[model samples]
Every structure is written in C-alpha cells, then in structure tokens.
Target chain A: MICEEMQERISELMDAELDDNESIPVHRHLSECQTCRSFFTSCQKMREAVQSIPYEDKRADYYETKKEWWRNYVRVPLPAAAVFILLFITGLIGTSMYLLQSDDPYVSGEHRIIYISEYPEIEIHLLTDRE
Target chain B: MDPSIIQKLRNGNEEARTEFYKQYRQQIYVYCYQLLGNRSDAEDTAQETFIKIFNGINSLQTAAAFRSWVYKIARNESFQLIRKKRPVALSHKLEYLEKDSVENLIESEDNARIVRNAIDTLKPEFREVILLREYHHLSYKEIADVMKTTTSAVKTKIFRARKSLLKKLSPYFGGI
Candidate 1:
C-alpha cells in the first residue's frame, strides 16, 4: 500500500484492531518501507510514553473529601431553604398583623358617619360599621 | 461495581456512597487529569463528577453498567470544564529521536511533559478518545458508550487521533 493509505491503517495496526487478513499486508509493507516503519514505531513510542507518565495519587483522601462534599451539598441548600421559608412566614405574619391593626377604613372595625348630601335646606347622614 | 453497593447507594446509604467514591475516585481522577492536563482542573472535575454520579445514582437502571455510566459522567464533566477554560494553545517541539530513544523518553520526566502537551493540542473529541482508549484502557465499545457514539465511530476517531498525535510528535520520534 502507498504511504497515504498506510498512514490511516498504521494506527489500527498499532492498536491491533486489524485482523490477520488485514494486518498481514500492512506488516509486510512496514517491513519493506522505511518511512512507514519509522512512523509506526514513533506512534508506538508515543503511546507508551503517554501510558507511563507519572501522576500523583491523591485518592487517599477521596472518601473523606467526598463525605464533606456530600455534607455541603445537603447542608448548604437546607439552611438556605429554611431561611427562605422562615422569611416567607415572617413576612406573611407581619403583613396580616399590619392589616388587622391598621386604622384604615377598609380594614379597621370602626363606625363612621358619612354625609350623603350637604345642602342649605336638607342634610342626610349614613352610619357605616366597617368591621 | 457490586450490586449490593449500588442497591445501598440507591437507598440513600451514605456509607455506600463513600465506598463508591473510594472505589472509582483514583481511576476517575486519572482519567480527568489525562483529559484536562492539569491537577487542579482534574481534581475539581473529578469532584464534580462524583457529586453528579451520587446525585443521579437513583436514575441508573442497572448496576452492571455502573462503570460505563460513571465514566460517561466524568467525560461530560471534563468536557464542560474544557469548554469553559479553552486553553489558548497546545504546542510541542518535534525532533528526531536517537536509537533506543523510546525507552529514554519513557524514562525521562521531560518526555512526559511533551506527551502531555501533545495531548492537550488535540481537539476535545480526539483527546477524549485517545485518553479513554490508551490511558484508561477502555474498550472501543466502552468509549463509544461514554462518548455516545457508535463503536465504529470510536474506532475511527481513535485512529484519526493517533494519526494526529503521530504527526505532532514526529520531531521527537525521529521525524516520522
């Protein structure tokens, strides 16, 4: 196969994804071609380098950290929700008390004399019990 | 993943949740670290992934599929962070390697840095496939499930991703 075609197959070949039928020709080509062989070899090396990189293992505290995370997950919203509910109740109570205590005619239980007509000869008064 | 642990997790057992976190944390963190290319980001992403997994555990239909399911969460979380950060550039020098250079590169710390940079240079899709397939040793089908793609598509992506990395690292590998 030409280099372009081999380029596509090279990865599959390295991954061992190719079946014997497909891999045999590619292996033959690599043996005969220096460029393809070099590229394939480099790809393998890169894979190995990636796989061998050293990384710190911080998983020792993962369980403890996860516990804290869960705690915060539950703790944060609960208090906030409670505060919100408490504020809502307080606001409702405050508004109800204000409405009950206010002297406004609409809400207050009081008697008032409303004048219907004020004329020189006639006068009429209506008593309203706003309770 | 044990079925009883999953059952306990579903039943809101905190100890089971902790055990689940302990079981998968390292692998998940390593997966994230490989994908994100930084310790801090990997840690944050892994933490978020676990939170998501626990929060959504009740939605899981089967315990046998927990590995795939958890990996799917990790991949999503890592992708989200990658999108948010969007590293500016991923560049590395390409130079020819001497004979027996692959062993030398594996032994040297600098080679590790080079590999990490090369991986970061890849597009997120390619990076995900490579990390899942190579570093995590996940099967093509498992990667497909995590990526929500076809197994054939995953294989194709892995091939393409390897090709891309090979091109980028040609300098280090003797200009191949």
Candidate 2:
C-alpha cells in the first residue's frame, strides 16, 4: 500500500482497531517506509507523554462544597412547599364546607330570611340549622 | 454503574450521590483535563459535569450507560467554556507548528507542556476524539456513544486526529 493509505490506517493500527487482514498492508508499509514508521512512533510517544502528566486527585473539598450547596438548595424550600400545600388544601376544604352548609340558593339547605331588598325585591336567607 | 448506587441516587439518597461523585470524579477530571488542557478549566468543567449528572440522572434510562452519559456532559461543558474563552492563540500556534519538527521533541516536563500545547491547539472535534481514545482509553463504540456518532465515524475521526497530531508533532521530532 502507498504511504498515504497506510498513514490513514495508522491510528487503527495503533489502536488495534484493524483486523489482521486489513492491517497487514499498513504494517508492511510502516516497516518499509521510514517516514511513516517515525510518524507512528512519534504518535505513540506523544500519547505516552501526554498521558504521563500527573493530575491532582484532590477533589474531596470540591465535592463536599457542591454537595452542601445542593443540600441547602433543596432542603430549605421543601418544608416550606409542604406547608404551603397543606395550607392551600386546608383553605380549600374550609371554603368548600362553608359553601356546602350555607343557606344560599345554590347550597340546598333550610333557610331563614335575613334581608329583603325593595327595588329588585330580592330576599337573602341564612341557614339557621347550619350552626 | 452499580445498580444499588443508581437506585439510591434515583431515590434521592444524598450519601449515594456523594459516593457516585467520589467514584467517577477522577476519571471525569482526567477526561476534562485532557480535553481542555488546563487544570482550572478541567476542575470547573468537572464540577459542572457532576451537577448536570446529578440533576439529570433520573432521566438516564439505564445504569449501564452512566459512563458514556457523564462523558457526554463533560465534553459539552468543556466546549462551552472553550467557546467563552475563544482562545485565538491555539489556532495560530497550530499553524506555526505545522512548519516545525514535533517528532524529534524530547520527553521532559517542558516537552510534555509542548505536547499539551499541541493538543490544545486542535479543534474541539479532533481534540475530543484524541483525548477520549488516547488518554481515556474509551472503546470506539463507547466514544461513538459519547459523541452521538457511529463507531465507524469515531474510528475515522480518531485516525484523522492522530494523523493531525503526528503532523503537528513531527517538526519537534527533528528530520523525521
């Protein structure tokens, strides 16, 4: 194979991604071509040199700080949200009960007349049995 | 991807979350470091990666895909920071190094820095492929998953990336 084709296959050769039949020509080219061989060798050395850099593994502090942040963010609003929901449900229930037991025309209950209007001749009634 | 840890994390277990962070933070940091070529940027990216992972872990369909998923997040986060900086020097340096002998370079701390500089000069696409394949030792299929591309595409990209790296480093290697 030509150097260009072998060059294209170099990474696969290094990574062993190429099957044996596919790699044979590339390997043969590398053995014969000094330039391609040097290129491949440099690539390997570069990978090693890059990988050898010692990265600091001290991330415990960052993890702790982030964990605390997430906790505070989530913890503070949860109980407040629960209380708000509870209050809303209680208010809903109270309003429903009041409406159900009231002597308004829509409530369907025994009533005593509380007020009578003159012009429109409308009567307002209150539920005496509700108490 | 421990199933029990995943279950606990899904169940909103704090300790499990912490354990998960401890388990994967180093690898993620190394991935970020290799991609970004800077310690501070890697740390920030890693932090953001974990936060995204924790917040979105519930949406992950299976525990087995955790590594690739987390890597995807790290790649995205690193790219975001890189875009913000918009370092013009990297591309210019790559252009300049195209005329130099990178292969003849020696392996010293200084040469390591040069190698890192060479890597940093790569476009994000090529740089990520090189880092994932060379430094992280991710499989082609795993890299495809992280990159959301096909395994063939990953292989091709890695090949091209290594070729580009070889060209960039060849000048330093002297007459080769």
Candidate 3:
C-alpha cells in the first residue's frame, strides 16, 4: 500500500481493529519508515494521557439539572406562542376571505330576485290549481 | 428503554429528559474534556452541548443517529472553546521541562505526559480523532459513526493526528 494508504489505516492498526490484509501493508510501512514509527509512538502516548486523566466534572448535577426547568417553563412556551400567532393570522385571513365571498348582505350587495313571465295559458292553469 | 426515548422526548415527556442526560452526560463531558483539555471549559461546553441537544434533539429524525448528533455538538463546542482563546489546561504541559516531574512519572521510561501536552497543541481535527479513540474508547466503526465519515477516514485522521502530535512534542521529548 502507498504511504498515504498505510497512514490512513495506522490508527485502526493501533487499535488492533484493522483487518488482517489491511494491517499487513501498514505494518510493513511502520517497520521501514522512521516517521511512521514516531507517529505510532505518539498515538500510544496520547492514548495513555487521555486514559489516565479523570473525566469527571466537578460541577454538581443539580446545576445542570436546573436548566431543564427553564426549558420546560419558558423555552418550550415560546415556540408554542409563535405557532399560535401564525395560526391566528391564518384564521383571520381565511375569515376575511369567507366574509368577502359570502352572499351575506352585510359584506356583499343584496341578492336581487328575478321575476319571470310564463305563458298566459300556463299562468291560468297555475291560478286554477291554486284556487 | 431502547432508542425510542428520543421519540418520547420529542413528544414532550419530562422523564425522557432526565434519562437522556443520565445516559450521555458523562460521555459528552468526557468528549468535551478531551477536546477542551480542561475541566472547567469541558464542564461548560458539555452543559452547552446538552442544551443544544435538548432544543434540537426533536428534529434529529433518526434515533439511531444519536451518537453522531452528540459528537457534532461536542465538536462544535470544542472548536468554539478553542477559538475563544481559552488556554487548554494541561495537567502535564510543564512536566517535560522540569526534571523532577518527569522522573516521578517515568519510572519505567514512559513519555506519558509528553504525549498529553503535545496532543493539547494539535489543531482541532487532529485532537478530535485522538480524543475519540483514547478518551471515548470508541472503535473505528463507532468513531466513524460519530464523525459521519468512513472508517478509513477516521483511521487516516488518527494517524495524521498522531504524526502531528509527535512533531509538536518532539522538542519536549528531546527529539523523538
């Protein structure tokens, strides 16, 4: 494998996670390349340093816990309010459109009744039936 | 439970919030400590990471992708801390120059502190890989999972990170 290819797999090799075939080339490279050997050594040192140091936080859990209260009480409410505002605006727009289009006399001109004249015979028959 | 806690949290369950914190708090803290190189900054950054998690976790969509989500937050917080010029507090930064500290820690001829301080000086990319490997003990696949990259990419970075660390620490190691 090329140096670049070998270098890329070296980390995995260090972790002993590389596949056997993949590890072979990197192993060969490290044996021959002084720079790669130093690189490998540094990786080991860095791992030790990280491992030895305690990862504990000195801060109390309660201090971190308090933010949850604020998240629940305040932060969550803000998004809800924003959604409410958007919905209210949409409702108003929809209502205005409905009112403007409706046949209601208040919003639109009055509906006029159309008078149609039937033939004289038909008109007489309708009067007779009504009588 | 399973990763479905993410769904419950999204639905506004309070218990899920506590569980979420309990689940990943230390891991994130460790990730932060590894990146920030100090306890105080790591603590602050870890808290900040959770806040982002709390606010944005609902939109994350994939419950299985939670690991990467947290790492992204940790990585961002780390770079932000570093950019803020907060000196990385190294427990071992000075031991190399002083003879006594070295003698005490190097009972068997180990350059442990030398490596630690050198790591602290690495650029964020290099430092991040080392931290993921060393501090988190993440396998290549898991590191790849968090990084949103291939396993090979993670490997290359770890190697490059190591190389950079060696170069940076060479003076302290008295020429590696």
Best by DockQ: 1
Per-residue lDDT over A1-131 for candidate 3, one digit per residue giving the tens place of the 0 to 100 score? 46556665776777888779878888888999986677667557656666776556667475664756426332463467789999999999999899888766545544333434764333221111111
- Please give the C-alpha DockQ score of model 3: 0.20
Better of 2 and 3 by TM-score: 2
RMSD of 3: 11.1
> Candidate 2, fnat value?
0.35
TM-score of 2: 0.69
DockQ of each: 0.33, 0.29, 0.20
Maximum-TM-score candidate: 2
Evaluated at residue A5, the lDDT of candidate 2 is: 67
Weakest 10 consecutive residues, lDDT, candidate 1 chain B?
A: B89-98
Which parts of model 1 have CA positions greater than 4 angstroms off? A1-10, A13-40, A57-131, B35-37, B82-109
Question: Model 3, stretches more than 4 Å misplaced?
Answer: A1-10, A14-49, A60-74, A77-131, B37-40, B81-115, B139-150, B163-176
Work out the TM-score per prediction. Answer: 0.62, 0.69, 0.59
Error of 3 at B55 (Å): 1.5
